[model samples]
Target: MPVIDITSDPEALTMTVVAEFDAPVERLWSVYTDPRQLERFWGPPGWPATFALFQLSVGGRALYAMNGPRGEVARGAWEFLAIEEPNRFEVLDTFVNEDGSAIDGMPTMRMTFGFEEAGAGSRMRCVSHFTSAEALEQVIAMGSIEGTRLAMGQLDRVLHDLREYSQGQGTQTEVLSDTQVRITRLVDGPRDLVWRAHTEPELMKKWLLGPDGWTMTECEMPDAAPGPYRYAWAPVDGGEGEPFGFDGEVTLMDAPRRMVSTEHMTGTEYPPTLNDLQLYEEDGATLITMIIMYPDAATRDMVLATGMTDGMEASYARLERELLAV
Candidate 1:
């Protein structure tokens, strides 16, 4: 019953979200593909949910029931029509009679889940096809829109805080010539996951650097905006660490694709770091390329001398491990 943003018209339903989580696609995919795991996080903010019937193959059914705060319950089911493992899933899901029968005069619908890599995390989009605009209206009215948002939000939180060891943190940026460092190693995991390691704070803290006492003090992504946006990672006062910190002002926020920013949106205390991150689908996985354009030869050379390629390889190693398990 919270504010539900209208994403599509009521008839031909379509909802698009490009959120970057702190985990790789494999981990994200497992949470949706594995029913036993999926049920654990299907409810909205305060509801506890459980899966009732599940058959995870093509043509199977994935059904779930949710218990509200007052103990009232609602049930839903998606008839799986296509299952492409971690890549795509199509299902005809909808509400039914309290007795579990298809409602006689209600909206019938089909929602498809598509997966692709976006910068530093997996981007999952739900394309819901309705029989009519009226049907689309009916489904969103039943909370499908907000429910999906909440469900995926939980996935992001889980991945960022996963028990996996924090691997690498803080790297000096630079421009690279394929040969100088002999350091370019093609990471086997998806590039999108690597993007998360760089930007998403919860994961970034584990692998990227900031002031010794740095913690993300503020972060925001406007639904639509230009020019200044903010990302603040600064040393925690009273914490035992150096007073290193950097603030970023938005150059771009394409979401799950790429983001460009200059240093310090709030003030100019810290030097600017020109950062560019890209994510794309490639042979069997995602390929991520990051370019840091510096002002002169000195800073670029200083960053290169830090041996970032090896640092990148080490952090990517953690990503590979998590994906294979999921």
Candidate 2:
């Protein structure tokens, strides 16, 4: 984690967060100023931000919305107060409505961010000033501290070259919390092809098989949200483990970009997991980010213990080789 410390002062009516990064101040500043890069980690794990408007100059404003996993949205805006280039800046941040109007009772804050060189790396100090101690406490009670930590934790990946950061790494999994797990893999294919591989039954059957000597026995894809989809697999020789499958309904879909669905074992009563998958394409390759929300810590651990990451890597490798290589 990059966050070093977070402190709140009731007397000063403020909250301060300090974080250190392995990148330089200039590099850190670029990500914050660029809307595309900022959106990558502006919100927490499951709730990703999308910047609708960004004006990066003093007296300018920015509008963004954080989209939740269950089709919820929270809108916010920032008015730039000061700009000091690669070093510091200040903004007035406030909660807003879909129409860009300020929320009547929501608290607003003034925030300052300072960046400085720390040896070969850099350090960032952020201080947010509130109108009253109650305002600071309100935000704290809303999981702002943990949310900030998790959001900034995603910066390391944004700072590195996408290929250098994920290529040859196979499928990597990170436990965001007890019930939330993030899995990422870089596929050597365009985002459209990767999306097709996941949605088109013919393309999926070619690489969706988890391991060697297995074949997809069934694949029923949904046409859109609220539509049910199912997949089943079996041993090639019918001599190994018994056939198993998963069924779910596609709750949300943003073709070639994002999809959210509920997943459960075909014939089991276990609680379904929420699967949020997002794809980003750069340099002719796609980075797949999947965040799975489990029912509980025990279920998360049990699923991970089943060599899920290894199986995913096997499938992705096959995707690159069989489907995308041509």
Candidate 3:
């Protein structure tokens, strides 16, 4: 579970729920953008939501109903106030009766959704604002917190299934030569965003760190021909030991199309490795291909034995999640 925080402040008339996902922002945003996917996890356990009309634009409306355990239906409507694709949106949400009319004197909450890169994935922050303290208390008494937690849990399952399906259908890898391996995946975002993710330090650190408890402390990418760069990492547990790090030089760069680099790790005995990455548009998605080459078969095998492939797969998965906000 990537979720870290869910806090509310009654005095402020706000309820904020924070969660993270191992998927791109667009993937998570689809929970609201796509009506079919939205219905899958919009309600708590045993209560599924069904949308009648849904849209993702300013002034657009979403009318939906959630069937209760005993088959009673609770209808709701949301009028979108603002929309910034793949990043943030604000909506006015209110409970409505079966006749599709807002319930008189009921609480109408203003909700905001934000998505940002957070350590190998994306963090989603949802804040709901009520008009008064009484209104906020009313919703809390209605079991809003627990219901939200359950809905987010369902969301985690949806993301898991999504990544599995994508891994089975969209990604491919193969051994190209005795010293090289090639990885290809159809990325969900734009080519420029993908290029920025690779070259920008601020974006790189968010997803490049292989797993939890590891942090990239230093990353430098200079703008120059044959750019020089360095990346360093340390364990978050504060264990007493030398930090693991690496440095490299960009051998080639062509904006949103291609890049090549020579990389060397601090503790590895293997010679410097060469990496070539290419990105292009295909069927409205970016097709990314990365070729990693070692000096020799022995060195390649030595690196592979260290579970480098597994680490890369994890990092790339994180990258996919981070790109959702890009």
Candidate 3 stretches greater than 4 Å from native: 162-326
RMSD of 1: 16.0
* lDDT ranking, high to low: 2, 3, 1
Query: Residue-wise lDDT of candidate 3 within 246-313, one digit each (tens)?
Result: 88888767688767778899677658987777765543556576778778888877777876767777
Residue 8 accuracy (lDDT) in model 3: 80
Give the Å error, residue 80, model 2.
Answer: 0.4
Q: Per-residue lDDT for 1-326 in model 2, tens only? A: 88999999999999999999989999999999999999999999888899999999999999999999899999999999999999999999999999999999888999999999998999999999999988899899989999999999888888878898889889999999999999999999999999999999999999999989899999999888879999999999866888999999998888988999999999998889999999999899899999999999999999999999999999999999999999
**Each candidate's TM vs. the true structure?**
0.46, 0.98, 0.50
Would you give me the overall lDDT of model 2? 0.94
RMSD of each candidate relative to the true structure:
16.0, 1.0, 19.9
TM-score (C-alpha) between model 2 and the true structure: 0.98
Instruction: Tell me the deviation in Å of residue 19 in model 3.
Output: 0.4
lDDT of 1 by residue, 1-326 (tens): 11223267543455544455555677778878766567546775334467877888777876777755333577778788998878788888777756667766676567777777767766666666777767766766777766666555445433443222122332223233321111222344555665565555566545343323346665543333245445555566667743433455555555565555555324443345565554434443543435555556665576567665655655555445544224
Candidate 2 lowest-lDDT run of ten: 234-243
- What residue pairs are clashing in model 2? none
